[model samples]
Target: MSKTKNSFNHFAWEYFEGLEKTQKGNTLIRKKGRLELICSYIGNEPISEIGSPRMLEVLLDIQANSLNKAGKPTDKAERCAGIASDVFIYAGARGFCSSNPAALIKSQLAKSSYGHRPAITHPKDFAKLLRAIETIVGDPNTINSLRLLALLFVRNGDLRRMRWADVELATGRWQLKPLKGQGKVNMVKDQVVPLPDQAVAILHKQQKINGHTEYVFFSQTAKKHQIISENTANKRLKDLGYQNIHCAHGFRATAKTLLQEQLKYPLVLVEMALGHTTKDPNGTAYGRFEYIDDRSDMMQKWADYLDALREGRDTTEFRADAQNKADSTAQLKALIDQLGEDKVLELLKNKD
Candidate 1:
C-alpha cells in the first residue's frame, strides 16, 4: 500500500485546495474547480494505493454517472474528464503517476467546438445588466467598482488588485505595477494601462468614501483591502437577471468587436487598446508610445459608443473631436518592421 501527498484519498481535494494561491497552485485552480468535482466521485480510495487499472475504471464510472444538476450525463462526465486530466498532468509532473487516464477523454465530448459558444444576447439583456448595476449604485462603493470595470475593461484578476496609488487623478489613468502578465511569464512583464474617463469616474467617487483606503476597489471583507474576487462582480451580474454573456468580459469582446469590425481601426490600435504584445518584438516595439495621445481619444470614443449601443440608440453620437482627422505623419512601417519588409516584398514581386 502506497501513501503520499496526492494519494487520491479522502483529503486529497482539501490538500489541492490549499495550493490555490501560488503559480503552480493557481494553475491547478484555474481548472481545479472542475477537477475537484470529479475527485468527489472517487470516494475515499487512496489514489496512490490504487493501480492504473482501478483509476481507469473510476474515470469510466464518472463518465457514465448521472449528475442530475448537470442536465445531460455526458456533459458532466466530459467536464469531469477534463478536470481529472488536469490533475493527472499536475500529478505526473510530481511523479505521482505516469499514465493519464483522463487524457483524451474530451474526444468523447459531444458535438463540435465543445458544443458551447459565447452567447451574445439581445441588447435588452445587456441593458438589464446595466440596470442591475444601476440598482447597486446606491451602494456608493459598488457603483464606483462597476464604473471602473466598465471603463478599463481590466481582467477581473487585475482589477481586484487595484490600489489607490495606481490612480493618477491628473492624468485620468491607473498605473498598476506587477500585472497579471508578470505572474504568467518569466520575461519583462509589468504593463501600464491608461484608464479612460469612465474608469476615472470610479476614483472621482472613491475620494468621497473616507478617501484614505489604499485600494481603489477595496473588498469589504477586510480593512484597507485591495483584492476583490472575480466572482464578486460576476455574482452581482447574475443576481440581476443578466447572464454571464453580457457582463464584464462581454464588454471586452464588445470593445474588440466594435473597434475591429465596426470602426475599422488598425489592428495595432486594437491590440494596444487590449494591451497585446508582451515579449521581445512585441515588448520593446509596442513601447514606442507613438500613438498614445491619439489612442486616448480613440479609447474614450469606443467607450462612448458602447454606452450608446447599450442605450438601444440607433444614432450613436461619436466624439468627433476624436474622429475628425489624424494629424500625425507617422508611417506604419516605422512602427512595425514587418510592414517595411512587406512593402519591399510587394515591390520585388511586382516589377513596373
Candidate 2:
C-alpha cells in the first residue's frame, strides 16, 4: 500500500482492526469509539500530513465537548491525546508517517481533574452497602452479578465478559484473560482468581440462569452480543442510590483498603491478587500464578471478613488468623533463605 493512499481514516481503521484481533470483548468497542472521535475531529487527511497542529486541534475540541457517565461536561483532552499518540506511533512504524507528531504535544494536554471513584471505605458504610446489595430488588442475575463483583473485586470489564468455560467451580478458580494490551507480549499472563466459597455459590446460582450462554452475565436484549452492558453493574448500584457514593469499579478500591488495613495482607500479594504486575528485588517479573495457595487462603478469609462485617460480627479472630498466616509465611521465607530447598523439605519430611 502506498503511504499517500493511507489516509488518517484508513490508518485508524486498520489500527483498530489489529486491536480487535488482540484485545477482548468491549475493549474493541471502546477503541473504536475513540477512533471515531479522532477521525471526526481530524478529518480524512493523509497520514503523513497530520502532525502536532492537527493533533492539538482535535485534543482541544474533545476537551470542550466530552461528557462523562453523569452527562456532565468534562475535559477528555488527555484521553484523546493518548489515542492520537498510539495511532501515530502505529502509523510511523508502518512507514505511513516519518515521525509521531502526536507524541510531541501529548504533555500539553490538560490533565483530568475528576475525583477518584467513590467507595465505601469505612467499615460501617461498607457493611451498609453489602446489606443494600443483598436486598436490592431486580433480576436475580443482576443482584448476584453485583455481589460477585464486590466479592472478587475484579475490573467491571473483566467481570461482565467472564466466560463460563474459564471457571472451574470444583476447584473454586476463575481464570481471567489479561485485559487489552496485557498478555504474554507485555510479560503479563492470564490471571487466576481463587474464588472463595461465597464467590463459588454466586457462580453456581448464575450458572443455573446463564449456563446456556457463553458469558456468565449474558444480556438477552443485546442485538449481537451475549455479554451484559459494561454499565449494568454501575447502573444497578446507582439505582440503589449509590450514584456517587459507590460504583462497580469502586469495589477494587474497597477491597484494596479493607484487605490491607483491616485484614493485614501483604501489599504485594494484594496487588497480585488485583491482577496488577509487580517486580521482585532484582527486577524480575513475578508469575501470574505466584503464591496461589496463599492467595486462595487470603480470598477465602477476605470473603469471611466481608460476611462478618455484614452481620455485625466480631472480626478480631479473623484478624488474628490473618496475622498468624502472614507470620508463618515470613518464617518460611527466612528458613528457605538460611537453608536450601532440599534441606527444608527433608526437615519437614522427617518431622512428619
Candidate 3:
C-alpha cells in the first residue's frame, strides 16, 4: 500500500528515527518493536483518523493475544499503549495529530498481574540458595555470570552485556551507562560499580574464556561479540530448583535486604551500589563517584559476607568494615540501633 507521510506507519517511523538520535541498545530496540506492533494493526491509516476508540481496539487486540516475559497476558498491551502514546505526542508536536489517542485509552487496557521479581530475602534462606547455586553445572559463562551476579548485584541486562572496555581490573571498578537509565529522563546517565576482590577473581576466570572478545560474557552461537542470553542464568536457576523463589535479578533484592538487615551497611551506600538515583534535600542528584571509597569498602564487605553465608557460618555479626573492631564498636552499633544509621553518622560527624 502506498502510505502518505501522515500515515500512522510513516509518522511512527519518523518518531523512531528521532528516538534513534538519543536512544540505543535494548531500550531503542524495545521501543521499535512496540511501535511495529502498533503499525501491524493500523499502519496505513492516517494519523488523524486513528482516534481513541481505534487505538483502544488495537491495544485490546494486543492484550487479548500477547503475553509478557513472565507469560502473563495484558502487560505487553499496557506497554504498547504507553509507547503509542509517546508516538502520538511526537506527532502532535509536529502538527500531525491534534491529540494523543493512545494516552487516553491506556486506562481501558486489561490490568496486568505482574508483581515484584521474586527473591529469597531471608539471610539463612538466601545463604542456602547461594550454596545451591555453587553446585550448578553448565556453561562456564552462565556459571560465572551467576557467581558475579551474586557478588555485584547489577541489573541482569547490565551484567550480561558488560563490555571489556568498561571494566578496569587494575582499578577494581566497572563503569558504564546502565541500560535502564539510558535515553530516559530523570534517570542516572552513568553508573560506576566498585569490584570486590571476589568479583575480580571471577572476572579473571571469565577472562581466560572471553578476554580476547569484546564482551566479558561471550556467546559462540550469537552474533559477533554478543554476550550470553539474558535468560541463561535464570534458566539455570530454575533447573537448580529456584523457580519463582529467586532469579538472576533477584540478587539485587537479596543483597539490598541482607546488606542492611544482616550486615548493617547504610541504605544510601546500598542504593548507590545498586545504581539508583537519589536526590538530596536540595533536589540535587548524587554523582556516581560521590562515595567511591565507602562504596568500595561496602562491596568488599558484601563479598566477604556472601562467602561466609555460602560456608554456612554465623553472619549476624558480620561487618562491612575491614577492621575486626566489632567488640570495640558494640556501643556504636547500639547507638545506631537506638538512633538510626543516618542520625548516628550525623552525630559522629558533629563530634569530629
The TM-score values for the models, in the order shown, are: 0.59, 0.80, 0.83
Candidate 1 structure quality by residue, lDDT tens digits, 1-352: 2234656643345446655654442445555665565556564554445554555565556655544434445455565665566566666667766767667556654422232323344445545555557677445655566656666665666676677776677886665544445544432244566666766665777777736777665657644344455667666666665564656556566556656656556677666666565334446555525477767777777667657765766523463433343322134344446567677567757975
lDDT of 3 by residue, 139-194 (tens): 89988999899999998998998999999999999999888776565557799999
Over the full model, what C-alpha lDDT does candidate 1 score relative to the true structure?
0.58
State how far residue 148 of model 1 sits from its true place (Å).
2.7
Q: Which ten residues in a row have the lowest lDDT in candidate 3?
A: 315-324
Candidates 1 and 2, the one with greater lDDT: 2
- Against the true structure, candidate 3 reaches a TM-score of 0.83
Distance (Å) between predicted and true CA of 347, model 2? 32
What order do candidates take by TM-score, descending? 3, 2, 1
- Report, for every candidate in turn, its global Cα lDDT versus the true structure: 0.58, 0.81, 0.86
Q: How accurate is candidate 2 locally (lDDT)?
A: 0.81
lDDT for 314 in candidate 3 is 71
Answer with 2 or 3, whichever has the higher TM-score. Answer: 3
Distance (Å) between predicted and true CA of 278, model 2? 1.4
Runs of candidate 1 with Cα error greater than 4 angstroms are 1-6, 10-57, 60-100, 103-137, 175-191, 219-245, 275-295, 304-352
Worst lDDT window (10 residues) for model 2? 180-189
Sequence-dependent TM-score of model 2: 0.80
Best by lDDT: 3
